[model samples]
Target chain A: MSSFEFTFWTIVGCGLVTWLSRIISFILLKKFRLPTSVIEFLSFVPIVIMSALWFESLFHQNLGHLPQVDVGNMLASLPAILTAILTKNLLWIVIIGILSLALIRLVI
Target chain B: MDDVLDARTGLKDTLPTVFGYIGIGLAFGIVGKASGLSPLLVALMSAITYGGSAQFVMVSMLVSHSTLLSIILAVFLVNARMILMSMTVAPYFRQERTWHVVLIGSLLTDETFALSMNKLNRTQNTLSFPWFNTANLTAYFTWIIASLIGALLGNFITDPKRFGLDFALVAMFIGLLYLQIIADQSMKKALQLTVVLVTCILMYIGLIFIPSNFLVLVVTLLSCGLGMVIKHVLF
Candidate 1:
């Protein structure tokens, strides 16, 4: 297929997958009243998921054993994590994280 | 009071998102353009795709002339978190049309998702479009504007490692996770332990197939689901 075909299908397929993942839960949830305990815990689900995701990227690696710790990793990750924690703002969080990583790499 | 927030409020919330997206998008644009996309086209893609990591992948793939299926698979994997995110926010949008929900889901990103989930958790009332759309629009605009700027003034970013900017995203995510736990201590402890344990186990397993971008998300999600079931049975 042509590049255009690929891009088009990519968009269409992704939109479908994304929509299905998102919309399915809503449809399913409508049929049953989830237990209150489940609901409460579910609320925290994102917190768990997001943290795991960010942690992996910050500390882990693409080509190695159990996330070998590098100085750059810590320097890039620590300050960014701190900024996100302290301010609770996305803009600042991203900026600070990127900045911190960049600075450490630049300086040391 | 029941139907209080609307476009105006949405517009207000959206402005910050737009600004944030624009600033960050500029960086992406520079990177993307240098990698290949014409600056203008990169800006266009930023507006259309309206996602951070996905756009990053798309530009790389497009530059390498990757197959359509390959690009889709890569993006699909990277954005799998959106599935969980969409599921989280789905309950709040039953009143809207289905197409609207799908389109909105396409617009979903880490920042907006974080904001929307918090808003929903705080209020038990039915959802509305204004605030939701407003917040999304803000982030979307920000990405477009930022990409435009970055593309226009492309430059090889100097050693970013020195400023420790690379750590910001991890830090931001950590901060967000910590805040969530603050609302309920048990969940907090459970999440913390789950993150640590899961990371240790995954690292021990040495699975490099999955992208690092997805680690915390996948493990934390699986563990949280397990934790929820355990909590359900115990109490």
Candidate 2:
């Protein structure tokens, strides 16, 4: 298939998968109750996923490669991490992160 | 009407989400456009997928010319947590019409789920549909608009990275993680952070063997399973 055709179908497929994953549980759980253990287990998913994402962003480069630290990204993340802990504001964290990265770039 | 008042309250409460969405959504659009997606296509993805991280993954995968199946699977895995999130919030809508419940289910996102669940837990009554609906809609539109504007400005402003917009997603995730940590405030807070850190380290090590796309799913299940086991043993 052509690239455009590929992109279109891929996006459509992704949209379908996303919607299905989200709605299916809502439909299923309406009738049945999950075990308390399972619910408690699931509560940890977000923190795990978010941490994985954060680490992947900071470290991973491409498929099947060892993690390589990008100094700029890592240095910039220090201030963002502090802002997140201190301010606990999403917008501020993003703003401070971007500003810190820009400043770091200017300096080094 | 009561519906209007509830919506107004919901919107007022969603101001922080609005700001967060605008920043990250604009970054998504800019990255999408920079990676050669058409402005309309970028906006369309935001509308249809309505997933922040998944859409980012989609753009990167597209740029790398990854297969359609891989792209679909990656996006699915990254967003699989939504199932857990949706199920968690589903009980609150037990009294609502099935159609309304389905509509609300479709609009579920990490941010909305977090906010709505917190509100539900604190409030005495069932969460009014309008209250939750209003907050979802505000974040939804804010994301769409921010993305469209970013895409439109993509041609004129060539380098988004110079402005450090590339870090937006990571920063947002960090902030969200912080909120999750603080909101729990359990005595196990340190243990929870340790689990997250250990899982990330393990996933990083797993990169040598595991495909990059599957790493998130594998690590999520592993870490969460480990956490449950530890919690079960301790408490």
Candidate 3:
């Protein structure tokens, strides 16, 4: 197959896989009853996933080496973290984070 | 008052995501162009896959000439979390039509899911297709447009970091995580703190041993499982 054929097919396959993973649970569970335990487990999904993603952002990892903090991101996070606690607004937090990081890059 | 899902409200609620997605999308497009993919293909990938990390990995794998099946499988693994996220939000759409449910699920992403969940908690409103579709498409178009621009600009955007645009999504994640914490009314404060703490600690250690991609799915599953067990045993 040509390179275009390969890339095109690959993209199509990926799109199918992604959409299926997303929609399968909804279709299946629509018929079957979700156990209470499953519901409880689902409740924890948002916070747990968010926490994991957020933490992942604060560190960098290399193959065969321990993870280390990205000091730049960590330092930039301070002001955004504070804004999150104080205002609890998503837009403000993002703006503050970008500006803070921009300022940090400018200074050091 | 009847529950309504106006596009305006949805667009307003999803505004924050626009900022995050544009920067990351630009980065993805730039990388795609550097990988020898055309600008049109890059935008198409963004539209079709609609996944941030998975698309990035797909681009890298394509550059390396990974098999089509392997790319599909890897995409599934990276996005397995979507199944869980879909299920989490499914309860809200139980009364909606099957087609609507499918539509919402197709539009699901980490950012959209978090934002919707937080909005639901804050407003205590029923989830409607109009509201969600509006929000989803806003972020969706932003991402695709940004990718196209990035591809077009290619070498011009050499370093996204110089402008701190690299930090946009991270900041968004931080904001969403904080929102989740505040919006969580399910578990007690102590348990919430424990789950988050355990998630970070376990993920930190897990990253050392496991590839970061696999670690996210495993860490999320383990942390949530442990949180449930703790809740049952203690609370």
Candidate 4:
């Protein structure tokens, strides 16, 4: 009755939505053997949208005040970014990023 | 992978990425563990949801005392990217049996996206769907093992304030962005600018005011419409 109920029932709702998204493909591909060109175009959908989401999450914070930049957040993140680029390794990124933050007190 | 690659290409194509997955997956697992949830729960969510950002969002929401509505809003918005991913694959999948698509879709995660995108870009003919399973299995195993380790030792590990762990996620994204931008210039510009603009809007405007999930909805609908318009007008 009340909206405040902490029911995990929401999982059922989300699962239903997720299921329907892929259901059509299963139906069509099995029965009709859908065309190849259609599949090729549809394949781009994930990467393009992911690129969008990635952009939104990463640059959204830094965009408005760019050029002059706020020293506070940028300083904390720079080490992790630099290490990841240089080493191309995850352990290095985590370590370098955390150490850079510990030393962040010295910067600001 | 065996027949597809020669002996020489083995060192170059597969090893580095697989090694990196071990570490990245671990970072993700431990982060989930540190969120105070059980590792079993984390594994289940990671396996079923198959979404990296949503996993992080769920953990962060748990930490920040977020309302269930807010958590759903954020995740729903975050998972909106999947719509674009699905739509792109939808038309072609019409032939595959339903359970097959469902089996693979449920395991679709970031690594799966990367592997599949690269494979599709290269191949010219009908793809064996098992490649999707290979990619998903690799990512799933890594996330599961790493998270269990992270969960058990989660309390003991030393680090910055919770703020630092938060920074770790941001830094990881930045590094990934830099690599991506280098590979494709126009895409990089679009993505980097998108990242900056969205972050600024969400941080300042706060997701509560505007339906932040609307960003995904708006962009996807616009892109789909543009595709339709181009098909009608240009072709």
Candidate of highest DockQ:
3
Q: List runs of model 1 lying over 4 Å from the truth.
A: A1-44, A70-73, A76-106, B1-20, B97-100, B124-127, B155-168, B184-209, B213-217, B229-235
Report how far residue A61 has shifted in candidate 1, in Å.
Answer: 1.5
Q: Of 2 and 3, which scores higher on TM-score?
A: 3
lDDT string for model 4 (B16-114, tens) is: 335334444456667766666666666655555545566676667666767767766666666765555555454444566667676666655544454
**Per-residue lDDT over B148-204 for candidate 3, one digit per residue giving the tens place of the 0 to 100 score:** 999999978787676777777778788888877776675588888888999999988
Q: Name the better of 1 and 2 by DockQ.
A: 2
lDDT of 4 by residue, A1-108 (tens): 112123233333343444444344444445555465554334334433444343344334333343233344467666766785787654466556656655674556
lDDT of 3 by residue, A1-108 (tens): 128778888888999999999998878877877999998888889888888888888888885788988888899999988999998888898888988888898988
Give the per-residue lDDT of model 1 (tens digit) for B157-188.
53323344335445555655555555334444
Encode model 2's per-residue lDDT on A1-108: one tens digit a residue. 127667777778998988888788778777878898887877776677778777777775555667777777789888988997888666688788878877887888
Computed on C-alpha atoms, the DockQ of candidate 3 is 0.70
Best-to-worst DockQ order: 3, 2, 1, 4
Instruction: Write the residue-wise lDDT of candidate 1 on A27-83 in tens digits.
Output: 665455667765665665666665564545545465554555666756666665576
What are the models' TM-scores? 0.74, 0.81, 0.96, 0.58
Superposition error at B109 for model 4 (Å): 2.5
- Model 2: colliding residue pairs: none
Over 4 Å off, model 2:
A1-9, A88-91, B1-20, B34-36, B56-71, B114-128, B185-187
